[model samples]
Target: MLDDNLRASRQTAHDRPDLQISFEFFPPKTDVMEEKFWDTVHRLAPLKPRFVSVTYGAGGSTRERTLRMVRRIKAETGVDAAAHLTCVGASRAEVDDVVRGYREAGINRIVAVRGDPPEGVGKPFVPHPEGYRNAIELVEGIRRIGDFDISVSAYPERHPQSPDWNNEIDNLKRKIDAGATRALTQMFFSNSDYLRYLDRARAAGITAPIVPGIQPIHSFRQIASFAARCGTAIPGWLAERFDGLDNDPETHALVAAAVAAEQVTELVDEGVTEFHIYTHNRSPLALALGRILGRRHEVAAVDAA
Candidate 1:
């Protein structure tokens, strides 16, 4: 079984030169965390990702940190960096200012999301009295500010607040019509969910690229909690794979690499060429997954030579 997986990985490495990948990161809060974040960035930057994005906090809580990180990433690593913009606690003017800031810094890629309520996820999201109402409005607002390459969020399992499929896909369409060039999905453990959502989006006449969000589980407990909050289902088999490994870090890490590799390998077979990875500010698992998908660290190779 292991040999078969290795052969498949080698085959993918040889055949898929068109595979494109991007990484998502969050701003570090403490000095210790900041050191770790930069290390992760420097490590992964050599993979030549399409882009690396810094996430905004709920209600623009990490606004300044996010902006600062992206700027430094672009300057120091020469990687195209994207900033996340959200309409939650801020008004339209405030959000627009953030967009302008990114433009002035020469960072033009924006991930427009109608962020969770300041209260928290699963709570009712109340847009500010003077703010853009939803993601569609946010996308429009960003478009008016600059000719930024915009990306919006998509949900394969349906948004927790969405009533049905039509409402969900309609909202996504409205965002695209507003100027978003791409849609990145929320992470899902089941590939079928993502493929079915892609089919539905195509059938609905949404033509933008819908990139699947792949998350390598650094910690199953934490990821499971996030899945529960975001309406992503955790299949029983996935749970069984991680079962009884809490105290066994060595074995747990191996399982994590194999599981995530299997997920992306299957997606590649299904004709999905682009991926957005949620890195959670760690490099080891994400690096392992990238290598499985045939990404090589260019700088490391040069140094070794």
Candidate 2:
């Protein structure tokens, strides 16, 4: 009887036909990367994502490239572009000027973050003396500069350098209070972790829409290294799914698509209607997953060419 009830509940959650997805891309560092980035954008923008975000690099080193990509997307694509702005090493005046620059470029959304330092993750964070103190401070500054829509990050297993889980949640609340309108969690493997985080956020009076960030694990070695750096644990079972297929690229791609599609299906069963996919400037996997979930690509039908 309990099993039957649980099945019914899952079906009820997945029955909702309306769903939304967004994507995140990094600033291209070179000509070849730039071509890949734009082609990925062209391929996936047809799905009409809620908003496509371009990430500013650590210490804002990719600031100009990010802004250029964002402005071009705003001008050429049908999707809204959210420019990421980080508070790590820049002064308040410098950050403010960047905000104004976005406004002048006709971009109106910001993904505010307290970015990692040159020392990278697992290192202590030292706030810049003249910069905005944190992501919350940066969000507030954006609000003062313009009527921009702001989004902030949420950590499910807690940030690596955070003192405790409470401190992490408190920091999220502070960002929302400052001016953030939505939250996107760090990439996680299990649905239960995201659900529990949502439960705790509700308990703490957080009501903003929280989008789960999804990464399609395509390469085992690369993903494992990235998981270690971001503090996201890779379950043994998950690793086993791709085991022994390392020598077979075709089999690996098929396995990757199946696994990613299954993850999103399970998330939908858990009442998750929104997703944010990290596209490492490659969209075939994401595009395939979207088609699997019944999202239609609308690009060629409405093109000027």
Candidate 3:
């Protein structure tokens, strides 16, 4: 049961009605996974997000699949779709072709990123000889292709490859100069980290919107492993919350919801009105967060394409 304080806070969130949201999804690799992916999409479509994004695989390995999923989401559900474009292994021409394709398809939003090295997160990143060297260059290249509302990545805890927080902030400013309209942070457990980063970003003269990325933890162990790779620190207290609950799925889900609700509500109090959720192609927890944010409404009828 929720405490009275939190229950009242949840009610306050439910009454606001003006919060904006977006969700991210990865392309499904198999038929069964595809079914599950659409189920997640259908369940959340009615909240009417700002735009939903489809993630690109490392080194553009899933380029075709990402484009297909983005297009399908737009055509079938009428929801605005943002395709993630990454600079990793592809040449400038190849990347340009993809950007032009998105323009022709009427998908105008892009999340430009300097993606993980093809080998994986912990490995050294080697840029393709003929490709853009980083996200800043990729953002410029996409701008050259067409008019796009571009978003780039921001690191609250600093990117794994960054030498320091200042370097990461400098890199983000460069991406903004290259035409990105917004920056979405890497997932962070502590709100203070994000608030500090925002202060530094403002001090550095970056005027674009820096959106926080929220991940609803479905599995603590799995997310902990991911945090290790992505440079996000898991607070010791958070780990304590999940302690000894490995076998308790129901309790785990409740705990996850409560933790996320607290995180979001606290951020909202700090004057944040827009959020980007990394859904990981699942729905229940994401939907719960939306409802907790006062986005509850009737479901829209959407047919999968």
| lDDT tens digits by residue: candidate 2, 9-97 | 55633256588889999998889998999999998988888899999988889899899999888778868999999988899999999
RMSD of each: 3.1, 3.2, 4.4
Better of 1 and 2 by TM-score: 1
Q: Give the lDDT ranking, best first.
A: 1, 3, 2
Those runs of model 2 whose alpha carbons end farther than 4 Å from true positions after fitting are: 1-15, 299-305
Q: State the lDDT of candidate 1 residue by residue for 106-218, as single tens digits.
A: 99999999999878889999989999999999999998888999999999999999999999999999999999999999999999999999999999999999999999998
- lDDT computed for candidate 2: 0.87
TM agreement with the true structure for every prediction = 0.95, 0.93, 0.94
- lDDT score of residue 234 within candidate 2: 87
Please state the error at residue 102 of candidate 1 in Å: 0.9
Q: Report how far residue 275 has shifted in candidate 3, in Å.
A: 0.5
lDDT of 3 by residue, 245-298 (tens): 899999999999999998999998777888999999999999998988888658
Off by over 4 Å in 3: 1-11, 299-305
